[model samples]
Structures are given as C-alpha cells and as structure tokens.
Target: MSFLLRFIAECLFTVYSVSFLLYHRRNFLMKQNHLIFFLISAVINWSFSATWGLAISSHYGAPALLLIVLLELKGLYQMNPMQLLFESGYFVAVLYWGRGIVLPVFALILNQSVHWVRHNRFYYPVAWILSLCMILVYNMLFRHVIAPKAKVETFYRSKEQIRFVAIFQVCLLGYLLFINLGRYYGVDLPWYKISHIISCIICFAAQGLLVNRGIRNSSLLEYELHTELLQQQLERNLRHYKAYQKYAESFRAFKHDYNHMMTSVKSLLSAGEYQKAINLLDTIHETRHKQVPVQHSYSNNNLLDSILQDTANRCEEQSTQFSANVYLPAGHNISDIDIVRMFTNLINNAAEACAKVTSDSERFIAITSRFISHNGWLQIKTANSFHGKVLIRNGIPESTKPNRDFHGLGLSIIDETATKLGGIMVIDVDQKEMVFKTTLLLPVNIQQWNKKDRLPVRGG
Candidate 1:
C-alpha cells in the first residue's frame, strides 16, 4: 500500500511538472489537442515513472524522468530544444532544491526525525502536500513574475547565452547527481544533511547571479537594437529631406519661368488662338500639380508631418491606398524622437503588410491619430491588409520574409516606444478579413505627463 501510494504521488508530480512546462511556453503555437496532450503526457510520465521505480533507484529516477519529460514536451510545444532543456533543467533544480530546503526546515520545526517521518503512516500525505505547495508557489512566481519578462527564445537564439546556460545546467546537474551519489553510498547522516543545505544555498546564489547576468546582457542587446533603429530612422529622414530639397529647387525654377509662360499664353489669346492658349494653360496646371513638392504633413507638428509624408510617398510608390488623419496640437509634452520612432514603425509595418497583397486595390493602409485634450489622452490607430499566415509570438508579429535580419525590428520598436511613453498598445487581427489593426493610447498632456518621464532620445 505504501509503495502504491508513493508511485501514485510520483506519477502525479510528473503530470504537474509537464503541465507547468506547457504553460510556461504557452505563447508558442500549440497544435496539439488538449485531450491528446493529456493522454501523451500521462502515458509517457506513467511509463517513465514506473520504469524508474522498477529498474532504477529513486535517487537517480526523478531527474532522469524529468529530463525525458522535457524532451517529450519539446515536440508538443514546438519549442527550441536547447531552450526547453535549459528551462526544464532549471525548473527541476528548483523543485529538488526547494523540497530539500522546505522538507528539512519543516521537519526541524516539528521536531520530527527524517527517518521516522519517512516511515510514519502520515508520510505520504505530508510529503504530497509539501510537494504540491512547492510546485504551486514556483509555478505562480514563474508565471506571473519571471515568464512575462523572460524572453525565453533569447536563451537559445544567442550562442553565448546558450553556452552559458548549458554550462550552468551542467553544474547544476553535477551537484544534484553528486547528492544522489552520496545517498547511494549511504554517506554519514549529519554530513550529508549539512552538505545538502550548503548545496541549496550555492544553487540559489548561482541561479541569482546567472539571471542577473542574463538581464544585463539583454539590456546590452536592447541598446544595440535601439541604436540600429535610430540609424535607420536617420537615413530615412535624410533621403526624404533630400527629396524635399530637390522639389523646392524645382518649384523655384518653375516660379522663375512662370511669368514667361503666362505672357506667351496671353499673347496667344490676344492673337485669337484660343485653343493654343487653353492647351498651354492645361499643361501649366498639370505641371504645377504633378511637379510640386509632396505634402507630407497631415498634423500641426513638423516631426509627425515628416514621418507621415515619407510613409505616404512610400505607399504611393507601391500603389497602396494610404490615408492619414492625424491631429496632434502644436505644443504637447510628447517626445519628438519617440513620436518619430512610433509612427515610423507603425506606418512601415502597415506598408510592408500591404505590399504583400497581390491585388493593388486590396493593398491599403490607414493611419489615424487623435488627441483628446480635455481627457489628456492621445490615440493612434492603424489598420492594414495582409495576406498569408501571420505568425505572432508573445504578442509581436514575426517577420514572414526570407531576409529577417532587418525586418522584424519595426514592431518591437513600436512596442518599446509605447512602453516608454507610459502607454499601452492593443493589437488585433481579423483573419477572415485579412486585416491587422493596432491601437496605441498615451497620456500626452503636460499635466498628466512629466518632462522627466520622457525616455532618453539617445539610442544607447
């Protein structure tokens, strides 16, 4: 009966662990059905747990079982193998060490000997409760706090990060395996207990240090990404400025020749050549309309005007139906560079999505920005048409193009800019309509926004 109870408890723990893993990487696209997931998880977990109990010592069974479970979950979640390994290894370490810390401390407080507790009739229930508590607490902390900011893919995406994580896991596994070896050899009680406590502390401190280092590395990468964005923005603005300068020069030359052309038209009219004068007038009007400087401003702010105008020109070049209804007042607390980053990314993404539409008539992007001064809110809404499957991970769309080196940064920039402005962005897609829409809401009034709250314009 005791053996059966232990087996059941172990099996349940396996289910709990794998379920937590699936939930941890929930943002990854999952194609498996819920029933199938449960069935496969249970069958594999039960088979492994049973096999370990029958053929392997409990000291080596748990980690071996969990490692296999992690690999199995990789297929179900479509997660990068190294990421799954790193995450699963860390999770198991936490589980094992957590119980190591909790159980001993708990036993000491109750004045219960470890041997007596293990052999006691209430052992299964007490152990199960403790295990459940630790797993629950770990899951909550990881899901609510760590998972949100983890950037899980980054662990495997960067070679350096992967190498570090691999080394960390190896060290962790060695420590756990060493403890098991000590148990297998029947090491002296007090010494093993002391070593266990020390190992737990070392494990926790090592994890904390590595996590801090990873965060610092992530920040450095973000700075690099931001720098790249700013350089790209500058190049775009420079090209637009050059185009406007040429247009200005052409307009001045047209003005210089305007009087001469008008005099010729007047002379032709005076000579009773009505048709010839009419033709000349038509040509002059067409030239003025077609050859004049492009209007890039839809709002009162010059920075926004430049961005929208540039976006409009690109859309026109691609035969996309682009429309803008921006109404930012002259003097608000919004950062100019932040605004540039925001709209530049938004419009560029929309234009790119629209560009994929094979039918010219179907390619359209509409951008609207409105400010409610009384409410101290700014709203930007952009909608575009896209074809093909859209891949979104952690709420940001992934690049569909073959050359992804430079493509996927736009939406991330928009997200970062919105966050810096103390605003929220909402994205929604209508699959049937093939439309993607995103809304960014910000508090723009000086009363609601502090100048000091503005993020640094320097990319670094």
Candidate 2:
C-alpha cells in the first residue's frame, strides 16, 4: 500500500509540474476540455512511472524524465523536442531545489530527522504536497510579475539557445543517470553527493543567465518601439504644419480674387445684358475656383485628415492625379501613431510607384477607406499606376529601386502595423492595366460617421 501510494503521488506531481510549465510557455493545454486532458495525462504519467519502476531499478527519475520528453514531442504543446525538454528539465530542477529546502521542514514537522525523511514511507507524499504548493506560487509569480517585464521570445526564438540548452540538459541527465545507476548497483561513492550538489548549482546558474538575457532583450525591444514612435510623431507634426500653410495660401488667393470678381459683376449688371451678365458671373466663378488650390478633407478623424492632406500635396507636386474618398467614423478608437504609420506607408508606396510613370497624364493614385462588415471592420484601399515590374515573394513586395537597403521597409512597416491592429493587408497588381492596389482591413469599434466635410480634390 505504501509503494502504491508513493507511485500515485509521484505520477500526480510529475503531471502537475509538466502542465504548469507548459501553461507558462503559452501552450495552454487546459484551455479545451480540462478533464479529458487531465485523464490522459494521468494515464501517461502512470504508465511512464510504472515502466521505469518495473525495468530501471528506480534510477531516480532519469527514465521517467526521458519518457516525458518523448511524449511531449507528440503532445499538444506544438514545441520541438529540445524546447520541451528544456522546459521540463527546468521545471524538474526548480521542483528539486524547492524540495531540497522544504522537505527538511516537513521532516521536522513530522518529528523525524532530515536523514530519516528520505527513507520514510511518507517521504514521496510529503514531497508531492510541498512541490505542488511551490509550483503554484512560482507560476503566479512568473505570469504576473516576471513574464510581463521580460521577453520570453528572446530565449526561445533562437536556434542557438535551443542547441545550448539541449546540450547542457543532456549532459546533466547523463550524469544523473550514472549516479543513480551507481546507487542501484550498491556503489555508494562519496563523490556522488558532491557531484549532485555541483550539478544543482550549475543548473541554477544557467537558468539565471537565461532570465538575465530575456530582460535585456525586453529592454532593447522597448527602446526601439519608443524611437519609432518619436519618428512617427515628428512626421505627423511636419505634415500638419505643411497642410496649415497650404490652407493659408489658398485662403489668401481667394480673398485677393474676391474684389476683382465684384467689380466685373457690377459692370456687367450695369450694361443691362442679363444673359451676358449671368454668363460672365459663371465664367468668373469658374476662374476663381481654379486659381485657388483645393484642400481636400478625407476623414472626420483629424489624424487621418493630416496624413491624407500630406499625400495629396505630394501628388500635386508630382503632377499626378489624386482622388481620395475616406470616411473614418467619429470616436475611432485607434491610436494616432498607428494610424500615421499604416497610412503613411501605404500612401508613400503609392506615390513612389506613380512617380516613376513617364506619362504624366497616366500617373494617378486613388485612396478610399470605409467601415465595412457592419462597422466591425475598417477597410482601407489604395490604387496607383506603375511602369515597372513588381517583385513579390511570400506576399511581400521586394524593392525594385536603387539603394535596396534603405527602401524595402515601407510594406514591412505596413504589415507590422496591420498585425498590431488585428488587421490584414492584401497587395494586388494588374499587369495589363499597370495598376497596383493594396487593401487593408482592421477590426474596429466605430460609433458614427460624418462624410459632409469630405473634400474631393483633383489636380490638373
């Protein structure tokens, strides 16, 4: 009965530890039908422990650990063997360290000496209870405090990390198996205990190194994000200043033309040529309107307005025909920087494409945005004409222009923005029509739409 109880307790502890580590690594096994997975895990754990006990002379947990590593390859975790092994080994190491500290307290509570604790019938059961409590506390601390501030991907994303960890774990496992086999053979060497302690310290040091590296990576990632945001803000402000200047110029031109128009109108009226006066007024109105530059309003969202205005100004300078029909609903919840990044990249790519066209009459860019899917999604589309071939790989366009190092980031930037905003971007090219189009869709919560202020500007 004692042996049976110990076996059951060991199996339970191993499953709990593996599952906890997997959850922290974002495997989230318990997300779907917890009871079913738990049952399956229990069966596997029992079989694993039984197989080790029946054949392997109780080699502390080497065979059992190896079995778990093999099983995880086919498990629902979606991790490679080395990654799974590292996670499992780390969990085991942490639990062993915790047990080394807490099991003595248990021994004292049970009125037994520390040496007697290991040989006692209740040793495994007590260890199981203590390990479970420790695992729970560590899981909470890892998820809430440590993980939020660290880059977990920095450790797992590199193949070098996997190879290093795998090699270290294999060495540790080999040493452990050797020591346990020596004990099974009644070869109680003094160095066995010393080697075990040294190995524990090494494992602790390795884990500490991993944690430090992850923190450093997280800091670097945050710094890069901050720098990118500052650049975007600077660009947005510059565009706003330019748009204001253009508006002022257009207002001044209209004001100057107003007096001349009044004088012409009065003279025509005095001649009593009613039809001619009407015709002259119409002609004057058309001429004044043409003389003043048209400032187009694209959206009620001010951020979108600024970006569109900037793009329109660029098109005008290039003598390209530009048309925009954009309506961003009131109370749009997206951040200004993300809006700037996404639209800026899209429009910049379009402008560059249209500028290369030799025929000025054929060069054109069009932009449109609307709330689609019953306001649950925002769809933005841009179309422009191009003269050269567009190279696309993995749905990403490669830069065809000179200075490839400096020019290929436009679409990548847009792709990153779309991913951040829970959106997708599609790029399409019509070879015969020489038209390149991009469509972006983002999930959004929009309250209302206001399209009355939209100005459709067409450049001659």
Candidate 3:
C-alpha cells in the first residue's frame, strides 16, 4: 500500500479509538468537565502522533498508540510516576517477551516519555530530544543503512513471533488481574480471557472519553470523596439540629409548666395545699426517660443504633422478640455512607425476611457483630435468623424476581463497597440462618499498603 493510504488507515483507527472512548464515558465515571481539557488532550495526542509520522517512519504509530494508553491510564487509575513506571514496565515486559512485540513495547516506552512531557510541560523539549536520540540509536543498532528493512520485517512477522507475543500479552494482563482478584468479589475466580478482552474494550473507550471529558482520575476521585464528605457533614449537622429542636420543645413546655405552677402554688398557698405543686414537678421528672429513648453509648454514628432502635420499637408495637448486639469502632476509616447503607440494606433485608413468619417466636431476627480473625486477619461478621430456603449461599445474590430493579443492586452494592475498601464479603446459609460477613483490612492495613509505595508515584 502507498504511504498516503497507510497514513489514512492509521488516522481512521485513531479516530475510531477516540470515538469509542467518548461513547463509554470513562470520564463521566468521575463526573468530569466535557469539553476543554478533553479537547486539549485529544489534540495533543493526535498532533504529536501526526508529527511523529512526518518526522519518523510511519511505523511510529505504535508509539502513538502507547502514548495515548499511558495518558488514559493516568486518567483511569490516578497513577504517579513510579506507579506509571511499574505499569509501563509490566506492559512492556509483556511486549518484550513476545519478540516481534518489540514494536508495540517500544511504542509504549516512548509513550512514557511523551506522557511525562505532556503533564510536566517544561519537559517537552527533553522528551523530543530524548526521542530523537532514541530513533537515531535504534537506526544505528539495526544498521538499517546496511541491513534490508525486508529482513527485519520478515523476522517480526513470523508465525511463532505472533503466537508468542499473544501469549505474553495474555499472561501479563492475567497476572495484574490476579493480584487484584481478592480485592474484588469474594474468592470466586475471574475469567481472564473474557475479562482482558472486555477491559481492553473499556480502556479504549475510556481513553477517548477521558480526552473528551477532560478528566483526571485522581482529581475526580478527590472531588467525589469531598462531595460525599459534605453530604455526611450536612446529615450529621442535621441530626444535631433536630436534637436542638427537641431540647427547645422541652424548654418551652417547661416554661409553660412553670407559669402554670406558679399560679397554682399561690392558689394552693391560699388553700394551704402545698403538696400538689411538688407532685407536678416530680411527675415531669419521672416521665423524662420515656420521652427520650436511651441513647446508645457507641456515639450517635454507631450505624446499627438507629436500625436496632427502630426494630425494637416495631417489635414492641407488634409483641415480637428482636435482639441485637452491634460492636463496631467509631470514627474509623470507613465512610459513614457505606456503613449506613450497609446496615440499612442488610438489616432491612433481614427484617423483611423474618417478617414473613407466621409464629411470633419464629419471627424473631437476631443480629450480632464482632471483630474476628481467621488466620489472624480482621473481619466483621453479621448473622441473622431466617426461615425458608436460603437464596444466596455464595457471596453473590441471585437475580431478584423479574422487574425488581433495586433488590439485586443492594448486595451488589455491598460487594462493590467491600471491594473498594479492599475487603471481601461472603454469604453463607445454614438451616434457618443466613449469614453475611465481610472482612476489610482494618484502616491500618490500608495505611500499610500505602506505605509500601509512596503516594502519587507511578512505575515505568
């Protein structure tokens, strides 16, 4: 094919890649701006790629592809230099082992330099100078002036080269995923081939969307977390506000009683009946306990407190037994929303599950939470009593009956939260009891992992 035709084909594929990224809305995952930054990113990648085509061989497209991928990864995982280096190293290693895969690997390596320059701004000239030097060095090493280009192409295009490269690519990705497997769903295995293909597709889409959306993952995650924190702050403040309201109401009632008592006391003094006014004050003091329900000692934020209290109240109203023991640390690293959602979803689920029982004794729900270590690893287990067949024995809950869109997402949400916190959740059923347990690396464990690698560092 003519050089012009080949260039056009590359352009087509590049455009396709960018378009796919937009459609997938990878940037939308973090709620990013949709115009300026994304346009700048796209123009930069393609412009540099076009420049490479003009200055170097048209084959420089490989590096362009790699450059885009690195930029995309930066957007996806919020990787720093060291982390980028590690990921690039892993990616390139996969390429290197495949022999003919050197072109793509070299492309990826070139991308590391390009991406660094793109972000650092001041490093642009350095990237170009280094890139030029690399091109010259590669030209000399291959002795392209002496050896025919056909021979090099022949070596790379061999059947064994293709197969080995494919194998290496597969293995590289599979290993990265394997490392993260326990961080996701329970102990269930992932289908590597399917996952890799899907992930690649998603990555392709993510890159383009990132360009269009002007999204940087780290910035976006920070923003999201900030928003959630604000929401919690508002909710906490709202709780305090309500407590103040209750106090205000109690104060007003006391003021009215005082005026009425003063008048009554004078009348009583005239009648010489002093005991009645004293009895009135005593009566208000006696009813105070009933007016204000007992507050749990574990702080107002103890997630299960409200749920348990509500449950107990309902049980009293219906004459049923409801017992609960929730022991969880306060102001821990876990987010309030996650704990709130988990407690609300799980307990409500259990409550509804047990409500179907006809007999009052059998209708009870027992909940307990404790920190347990299996193999000396910290985990929290919550078990509830239920009747009838257990629907989900494995951590994964089965599909809710048709048209119930929200039911299945509860457990799925639980699984997702557990995974995000780098924890595992399991659901097991025995006789009439359904137990859901999730073990998160105590916040300390996360700190330890962060210590293993410094923040904002990417590996090349």
Candidate 4:
C-alpha cells in the first residue's frame, strides 16, 4: 500500500512537471512531436522512482535521470544545450525540494490542524487530496506570475545568469540532500518540523529574489535595445531627408537651364545649321543627365520608400546587389513605425547575409510585395545570398554569433511585429542555391487600391 501511494505520487509529479514544461516552453514544444517526449520522460521518471523508492530515487537516481532528460530534450527541441541543462537542473532541484520540504511541511500543518479529531480511514485520503490541491495552486502561481516575470528563454541567455541559477539550484539540492540524510539516519528531533517550515520560507524567499532580479535585468536590456533601434531609425530618416534635399536642389537647377537650352536649339535651327541644332540638343540632354540626381522610388509609401532607398545605398557601398518592388498603399491600418521596424530588420538581415558571401556576383538581396485584394492580405518576400549553415527552431533562425545574448533579436522582433499586426512570417533556406528567403503575409484593407489599379515601384 505504501509503494502504491508512492507510485501514485510519482505519477502526479510527472503530470505536474510535464504541465509546467508545456506551459513555459510552449513556443519550443508546440512545433515538435512533444507528446512522445513527455510520455518517455514520464516513464523514465516513474521507473526510477518505483525501483529505488522516492527518497532513494531523488538522491541517487536523479542526476543520471537529469542527464537523460537533458539529452532527450536537446535531441527533440534542438535548443541551446546550456539553456536546456539549466532548465532540467532547476526542475530536478524543484522536485527534490518539494518532496523533501513542501510535502512534509503540508503534512505537518494538516496533522496539527486535525489532531482534535479522532483518526479515521479517510484521513490519509484527505491529506493526499490537500497535497494535490497545494500542487495545483503552485502551478497556477508559477504560470501566471513567476514564469512571465522570469522567462527561462531570456534568463538563460547570459553565462553569468546561468551560473547564478546553477548555484541556487545546487544550494537547493544540497539542502534537500541534508534533510533526506537526517531522515535516513532517524535523526528527527522535536524542532525538525519547525526547521522544515523555516527552510521552506527561506527557499521561497531566495527563489523570489532570483526571479525579481531576472525581471529587472530583462526589462532593462529590452529598453536599451528599443532605444538603440529608435536611434538607428532616426539616423536613417535624417540621411534620407538629406538625399531628398539634394535631389530637390538639383531639379531646381535643371528647371532654370531648360529655357536657355531650348532658345539655343531654336536659334541653330533657324540659321539652317541642322548639324549644330542636333549637337546643341545632344549637349543639353547630356548636361541634364549628368547634373540631375537620380532618385529611385521603390514603394508608394514615403517612409518605406525612404528606408528601401537607404538600404539600396548601403548595399551599393557594400558591393551587394539590392532590388525592391513594393507597392504599399497609404492608410493600410498598420502603423508606419511597425512597417519601418519590420522592413528595416528584414532588409538589414538580408544585406548582412549577402555581405558574408565570398563571391561578389553571388551577393544579392531581392524584395517583392503583392497585395491580394480578395483576401485582404499583403504578401512580401525577401531573398538573399548566404554561404553557411542556418539552424532554425520554432520557425526562427538561431543566432550563430559567439555572444548570442545580444545578436539574435532581429528576426524575433520582426516575427513579433508581424504577429501583432495580424500577419505571419515564414523563413526558408535553400542550401543548393545558397539563398535565404523570408515570406511575410500581413492583413490589410484598403478601399482605394485594387489588384488592377495598383502600380508597383521597382528599383535596384
């Protein structure tokens, strides 16, 4: 009967662990065949618990089981190995702490509260139900409060953060080991229950401190990144404005010379010097072509066109070919800033990838957009040259930089913006052609523009 109860408890814990993982890592697990992974994890956990008993399994079997679970998750999810290890370690520590500290603490409280009543057959069942309720409440708190504040994905980005979390989990596991050792040696004292409650309080406080720190750090980092992006956008806008100013001045000069050049051609024609008239017309055309600033419009929307033009200039400087054929109509319901943010990242990433290609002829970036009036969806596609391996997870590419903490937010930002605007972003990598392609579908409703009337502005 004791073994059966222990087995039931182990199974319940498995359910709780799987629930926690699914809730926290839904973005990672949802794309993959995670049901089988969960089932296998539960089997491994239960088998160890049943064979060695809960106490022995937690102490002697957990480390090995952690290694197995880490490998399984890595193979299934293709997540950062370090991140996965930290996640697995924390879960194991929590399991040990709950078994050693939380359950016993609850049992102590329940025993004291029900001491006035006579012992009955329903007592154990009532206690088990209460314990389950406590677990449920904990899960709710974790999902709503703790997980949101301290996202494991954000927390595990820094090596220092990983080390900090590892230290906390190690301390937690060590404390549980000590408590288990006392139990194994029959070292229970009159004050043991009080110590258990106090230890639980200390553990909760420490975990809360860690979570609070993570929240603050993540928020600050996000704020800094946002400010930096805004600064870059401002600079790009300024450069675009200057380019327009130059073009306007050049156009004004050409207008001033137009009448004088036409008068000279008229004089030569009247004098019967047909050759002189042709030569004068040729000179005028050559001067206009040389003096005028060539402005290429790539989209109907002014801001988007400016961004594309600026990207084109940068691509030229970098010796990477850039082409854009976009027709974004005004008042598309999506905000201008969001449009800028999405396209800027998309173009910048493509340009960066193209710059990495060894062959100049192979370095190119192409972007095209189409609006499906019937579906009220705008489709945008970007293709660029890339020369290396790309690892994609959860529909986003992984950062290949040495310091991944700061380098991988571009695609994520674009994906997030697309999602918020009722759109989707898809990425495709063609190893055979050495091309990286991104397709985005954004919903837009424009009463003024249709498929037949829309004129795409194409430039390179």
Model 2 TM-score relative to the real fold: 0.58
User: All candidates' lDDT scores?
Assistant: 0.66, 0.63, 0.44, 0.69
Per-residue lDDT over 1-460 for candidate 4, one digit per residue giving the tens place of the 0 to 100 score: 6446555666675676567556545445343666787677667766764554333224566677567667657645645555576567766655544444444554465654222211223444344434545556665775567756336445544445655766676577667567656644554543665676577557655776775586567556655666776777788889999999988898889989988989988988999989999988889888888888788988887788878888989998888888998877543666877876788888878887887899988899998988877767889999999979888865678777775555576787788788778888899999889899999998887665554556655798
**Ranking by lDDT, best first?**
4, 1, 2, 3
User: Considering TM-score, which of the candidate structures 1 and 4 is the better prediction for this target?
Assistant: 4
- Cα deviation in Å at residue 198, candidate 1? 5.5
Encode model 3's per-residue lDDT on 266-333: one tens digit a residue: 78777867687677657666655545444433223434454455555556565556666554433235
Q: Give the TM-score of candidate 1.
A: 0.61
Q: Give me the candidate number with maximum TM-score.
A: 4
Best-first order by TM-score: 4, 1, 2, 3
Q: What's the lDDT of the predicted structure labeled candidate 4?
A: 0.69
Which runs in model 2 stand beyond 4 Å of their true positions? 14-18, 21-46, 53-140, 148-195, 205-209, 265-291, 311-326, 337-368, 372-460
**Candidate 3 residue spans exceeding 4 A from truth:** 1-244, 251-285, 290-320, 323-331, 371-379, 432-460
For candidate 1, lDDT tens digit of each residue in 1-460? 6666666667666656666656755445464575487567677766654554222225665467557667656656655555667666775666666656554454555566444454565563456556656666765765565534455434334435655765686578566656746654656366566677678767766775575566466556656766765786777778768888898988998887788999999999999999999999999998887768644456655567667667777788999887777766434556877877788778878887887899998998887776666777888899999989887765677787664534665676687668767887888988899999999987765464433432212110
- The weakest ten consecutive residues by lDDT in model 1 span 451-460
The clash numbers for all candidates, in the given order, read: 1, 0, 21, 0
Looking at model 1, residue 168 earns an lDDT score of 85
